[model samples]
Target chain A: MKTLYIILAVFFLILSAIFSYLPLGTIALIPISFAFLFSYLVFKKSETPNNKFSKILLILTIVCLIFVLVKVFFIKNELEIDTKFEQQKIENNKDAKKDLEDLENDLE
Target chain B: MKKTLLILVLFFLVTSFKSDTENPVKSGESLVYSGSYNMSGLLTQIAQVNMTTEKVTTAKNNYLHFSCSLATYSKWDSFFKIRDVYESYVNPISLKPSLYKRNINEGGFIKKEKYVIKGSKVNSTVSFKNNQETQNSFTIGTNTVDVITFLYQMRTVNFANFKVGQTKSFTIVFDEKEMDISLKYMGKETINAGNLGKKECYKVSIAAKTAALKGKDKNIIWLTADEHKIPALIQFSIPVGVGNLTLKSATGI
Candidate 1:
């Protein structure tokens, strides 16, 4: 189990480092931090499970995750807004208004 | 406890020998649905879908050819025109698709895909309007069916055998990946089916999320409550409102 934990930790660590250079790179921090917590808990039976190197890696991962969360919540992108749906709503309202007018004219 | 376990095992063994049901897709028949896409209850666009099956002779053998086409009413063509056609050549007995083709023209972005299945393998080819072509191959089970074929298969199924609240799931390997479908039977209801008027229908909810359009919403389908099991209405949630395709007329009885 200890070896398996080490393998998973190393795999996720490499994957996180690689993906951190791509688009939405900050998302990679999630897996890295999750892997750190999981590996530490599972391998805590070992004498040096909380070694300085592992502790520092876990801290860095958490810091990166915090930074990403803050940036995503605070930053806004105008282009990401769904303007197409808004346009459709406006068009549908116009059609409804026309239909109502035709109904009123028929009643008159 | 041991005696009861033995009896349970014996019961399962006996039930495991049940016979398979026959395929229910009839040749030379078709289904048509016509409805409008309303934005927040305001009618904005209209859509019509037609699916038909016929006997055709392919190069290698004779097969039942199924064709389904979806077209937006010409009035709404200026807004968002969609002309999609799906064709599948299926085994007359097994009802498995031997060859399938899809031609889609949505919002002027055109794409074409073809699948040729032989025994346990399928070869897929896709081409875009921009002249990019990709070819791939995949292994599939003998009972594999494409999306269009799956719809017709659903129509032919004996829903009465399944209890209400029962969910049927199928995984289809297409477009290079497996897509999971979960269809739940939601009891009987009477719905106004456009020109068809009010009819007894079996309500089924397809829990496929409409994430691309807007908030997560399930696609609801109402099948005519008879052996034919025709679809009365299909409602989809979009970014703004619900889009429905209701059955208006019928043919090929």
Candidate 2:
């Protein structure tokens, strides 16, 4: 029983860590909560002194939770125009203008 | 007597298709929106969408250029970068599109498409990531238009005459194919219009007969009820979950 809980706690902790690193915002909280719950279960089931592994899992979950919380509250979504895209857009405009002029000549 | 009746019928047919109402969207107008994904009711903003219009003068003709672009936010750029632009050149008064272009680059997948519309026929060209290009021509309906022009033309529709639950259909050329699109009026709704604050808007639902768009009424949009008729909010449901685009700012209305 304790082994299963430990495995689950480790899996959820890794999942939450990945989610926290991404731009998923508060979604990491779901896996973080699960990690905490399973870690607690493992800690309770483990014999004394052997609870150190479970404690490590709890600490990792807390770290991911805090990181996600900070991002959700402090980070503002802003766009930085891609320079390559801008150049591509300019080139497209030139081509489109030439095409339009050709069409106008055809119509005339 | 028969000749007179035939002329009268032709006059009515021509007048019925002509709308004298002024266009609601004006050149120099721009609207910015924040695109967000909803997961279990939590909203995570992912991209910024900008819609702008400008007046362009060709060698012998003048037109209105309507452009919409979507760029992933700086933080999300590294994960799955996206920079897509859609443009339409249309008649200033009638809003009939003459040229349309789409440039899409998402996560390294690149595609370019253009359509030149002449009367009831469209000349289409497409280029993919592998540098393969194809050109084709298609006959379209008199009222058919490209997707970008269709979006702008949606504002010109006189919704006051529409009854609740009334549906208006349009044909839009997208991805080199003509598809049927429908908009159903769901009446008036007041929603949070982001930076514009609370606004009363016309609630409408969109339906398309395509695999990409699923569900009947899962995609809905709110356009401000004012003369500008700006698209204030949009809610769409995908296979995974729901997503939204909320208006962030408006200028040159």
Candidate 3:
């Protein structure tokens, strides 16, 4: 039973790694959380030879979760800040200014 | 036979003159405009605006319910597709909006705004798609109209009496902000349109004083030189291109 739990934990950690690379959004967090659950149970209250493996898996899953959270939440809306204040900065952009100039000329 | 022919000519002329007295804002009247945005001669059909005004009698007041829907064409749908519907109820006697509602979805962002006005104060609430909500208040005057109702109110003004370069100013409350909009009359001009070709129209440029609208937003509207005062053509200078919305058709007015 202990080996089974370790295998399951390793399987979920692998999925978390692949999904993180694929950028699956909040879905990637699910496997990572499950990996943590399985790793803790496999190593619970035991100092077996496999306990070291469980500890390593647990650390890996935690790191992957942090990465997924940062990618999904923080990196997704980088362009939003530009759009929110883009109206005031329209003149500073060369392409936008040129387009606007052409627009005014077209109106006349 | 000559007498009969003369009577027929008189009847035809009388009915032709009757079209000149068309009341644009009467119940069930509708106007549709289709246009495209041109960027450095590259044209793309980006917008279509439809407006319908109806006169209704409620238990308390006689109101004009105006509905305006604006949408982007399929070509521009890939970047940011907008489907917005704005409806406003105005007391025609006082020209003030009693209620206004907007359902807008641009790109993936969704927002719904509801404003209930009581005399000089307004209670407004906005519900967004991300489970976020906001409430606001505004002190408006009796002359303050919503954006949709403002179009109808502008038609009621007497433009012919104003001389060249004359300007008219009005305050309109839009999206939680009171905008001071000035329309400068640029004299009468003749322009060609897809449907109403070679028609003479009154030219007016928009100068709005509000943070909600940026200074880069420039617009010019041409109203028909008729008694009903229908908008003939509207051109806007946007960041991408100059959008031209020409009146295509009207009915029931």
Off by over 4 Å in 3: A1-108, B1-24, B193-197, B211-218
Kindly give the stretch of ten consecutive residues in candidate 1 chain A with the minimal lDDT sum: A76-85
Q: Write the per-residue lDDT of candidate 1 for residues B1-253, one digit (tens) a residue.
A: 9999999999999877543233566788777776555543434335567788888653345667777877766544656677777877776877777677777889898888877766667778889998979999888766667887877767766666679888877655556555666788888899886555788898887754324334332578898877667788888776556777777665663
Per lDDT, the best of the predicted structures is 2
i-RMSD per candidate, Å = 24.1, 1.2, 19.6
By descending DockQ, how would the candidates be arranged?
A: 2, 3, 1
Best first by TM-score, ranked: 2, 3, 1
TM-score of chain A of 3: 0.65
B1-253: candidate 3 lDDT, tens digit per residue: 9999999999999966553123346668777777666555534455567787777554344667787777665434556776777877776665677778777878878888877777778878889998878888879877777888777777766676778888888888887888888888888898764455677888888878654333432588888777656787888776445778878776666
- The candidate maximizing DockQ is 2
Error of 2 at B252 (Å): 0.6
Candidate 2 on B107-199: residue-level lDDT in tens?
Answer: 999999988888888888999998878999988899999988988888887776678999899998887678999999999999988677899
Evaluate residue A67 in candidate 1 and report its C-alpha lDDT on the 0 to 100 scale.
Answer: 53
Each candidate: how many clashes?
A: 0, 0, 0
Model 2 chain B TM at 0.90
Ranking by lDDT: 2, 3, 1
